[model samples]
Target: MQIEIVEVLDQERAMVAFNSPVGSAAGVWKGGQGLETGTHHVEFEIPDEVHSWSLVQPTHGAITGGGARGGDFVTVHGQVEGVGEDSVVTLRIGPDVIFVEMEDSVERLNQGDYVTFNSPTVEIYPYQT
Candidate 1:
């Protein structure tokens, strides 16, 4: 159930939509990790943080953010130090080390992958001039 961040709708709320495989796979994304992944056209409201976000354009992926309410699911993104050891993926967001579980068990995230921890990430969408 690997998905790609497709659009940014409400920046203030950190609301966004990600595109996943059609059918049941899509449902899996919306239901787990407290990420509360949304269905088609569903906008997820990403919780906020006390610190300001640092943004940059990724060479290969898009960005999104969320945090678990009162929990450690902080909105973090950085180069993947490693990924998926039976459902857990580790990310290094600056000086902090963060761990994320792959709710969508089918997807394979890899090392050196750049993920969120910043806002307004510059995504170069394929477009027509």
Candidate 2:
């Protein structure tokens, strides 16, 4: 779906918030994937992990297979630790842990629920404001 960049929270980490279609409330992904705040035409495979985030990969599970060095690391295969305010989803993958800021439009996730995203790429197009 087409989306607009709402806020650039962590440009260095590519953690920018995007405005959902509805408005006001925004969503964030693990990486920027070369996206900047403005108008962006994006095609994302919605994840069932409440957050419904997409990763910028060419093939599913190829980069995270060991060390391919892709910035899109949202494929956190583990149980959810908790859900905090602002829709931050915390999850655990073995000894490692991850946090995902979810889109308000997504469904809510429960604690201990299994979460994983196999989507390789979230196609993006940057538009000038």
Across 1-129, the per-residue lDDT of candidate 1 in tens digits comes to 234544444454443445533211111123322343332333222222213433334533322332222222333345667866565556554443445444443144556666554322221122112
In the order shown, the candidates' Cα RMSDs to the true structure are 14.8, 14.0
The C-alpha lDDT values of all candidates are 0.38, 0.45
Q: Please give the clash total of every predicted structure, in order.
A: 3, 1
Best by lDDT: 2
Predicted candidate 2 versus true structure: per-residue lDDT over 23-114, tens digit per residue: 22223444346656776654333234343543222321211311122344423344667888877777554443455556653245677666
Q: What lDDT, from 0 to 1, does candidate 2 have?
A: 0.45
Query: In model 1, which runs have C-alpha deviations exceeding 4 angstroms?
Result: 1-74, 105-107, 117-129
Query: How far is 52's C-alpha from truth in model 2 (Å)?
Result: 1.6
